[model samples]
Target: MTSESQTAGTRVLHLSSAQLARVSRALDGDEAAAAEFDSALSSDPVRLLVEVLSTKSVPAGSGVSYGHTFVTQHPTVLARVAIGYGHGLPRKAGNRAWVTWSAAGGPAVRLPIVGRVAMDEFVVDVGRTPVEPGQLMCVFGDSDEGEVPLGDWAAAIGESPVSVIACLDRRVTRSVVE
Candidate 1:
């Protein structure tokens, strides 16, 4: 009843192997248990939604964002998206990371984050695709839908998968969709 030795699931990090085994046993179940567990952890529900501010056309040689770290190789559309380092987005991801956006009634497309990330915003090269202001841009979410996976976001910041999910600041609005 008191002391017993057991092994735990490898996914749990805080517990010793024996203690983990005990927890694993307690949480373990049969067919129904497996189904429940799979359903619970199958996908991440959180998505960082950055509102699109504006869009414009820049010449092929135009410098993008701050410092001209990225220059458009061709005339393209640049979109400024709200939410940046101040909102828990990693500034290091600037000019390195990318996001997913779809023009009105258009297919989802991957857009590169260009130039330096500012305290309040970042830029994306959307290429001739027309985008409107106030449209929401997905910074990280379901990859099946062409959005950037959480792993990629974590990788951009030199961190693990869980760290990116934990980086959301209070500035990000949360709404329950039922």
Candidate 2:
């Protein structure tokens, strides 16, 4: 609904239920469903903050591009994350892309990708987090206290705020907490 400037160099873009509905229609084409989904995500206090990590090391001879690249080494922790380009994650996010994140009781962290990001899957370092399937990932939203933000990631990727919100699929679970 309103845009505010933060001291941390990130701009907070607020969206109301009505504004989010418009974006949902543009992305999903079902106004009713979109409205419902938007209502769920908007009402939540915990925001999404996607952190990309590298899964493998690219060889020196190999040049990693957008969607094509191979892991020349082993022991790669390929991050099977829930967020991807289809969810408004940036397509330009190549291998070794950086994202800021923080766990339930840990400090904010930064991680990188090891391989090319597929349509639905992208990798991350996950240095800690003890990641497992369905471990609650914040791909793009606000943070605890609405302080640490993911808005910079959207701007850096040249993605419109509306498009980012639309990218989030209805399948992703949403929860609200005070």
Candidate 3:
């Protein structure tokens, strides 16, 4: 298995425009090809996952229920990520939401939230992990041995994974890597 330092050096390698076009043309209606494409793009294409640290510390007692509980904490580190309730993240995940994240050397760490996810922000407890802004936050991507399947995440929050993925507006940018 690769170490954190090894994976951290790799830059964001995206698919070339020509290569994307070729794949698009080659797999017009082939199911297997489509599946392969999905696996390659979403899975560990580089045989490694990016390791990023938390930027801020979202405090406790911050009520996060939608149209319900009110946040009571001030110094909280809201995950400055793109995915939110509108992007399929559970709005009802009032302090129950957990995401598998990777720090330096330890196994993929599961970061628990303190409140419900807002329209564009979520809180995470970064006890002592050295994190900072612009770090790669794997909201819903690959994992070490298993993956945080979008379907499972949706099920946990009582939402349809299909609709959750579909609701990802065009504003949410996506990049394909080879």
Which of the two candidates, 1 or 3, achieves a greater TM-score against the reference? 1
The local lDDT score (0 to 100) that residue 39 gets in candidate 3 is 47
Tens-place lDDT digits, model 1, residues 150-170: 567667768654444334465
lDDT of 3 at 167: 45
Better of 2 and 3 by lDDT: 2
TM-score of each: 0.70, 0.52, 0.53
TM-score of 1: 0.70
Summing lDDT over every window of 10 consecutive residues in candidate 3, give the lowest-scoring window: 45-54
Q: Model 3: per-residue lDDT, tens digit, 55-111? A: 555466654436434464455554433345654355665465555555555566555
Clashing pairs in model 3? 57-76, 57-77, 58-76, 58-77, 59-76, 63-71, 64-116
What is the C-alpha local distance difference test score of candidate 3?
A: 0.46
Poorest 10 consecutive residues by lDDT, candidate 1:
3-12
Query: Candidates ranked by lDDT, best first?
Result: 1, 2, 3
TM-score rank order = 1, 3, 2
Highest TM-score among the candidates is held by which one?
1
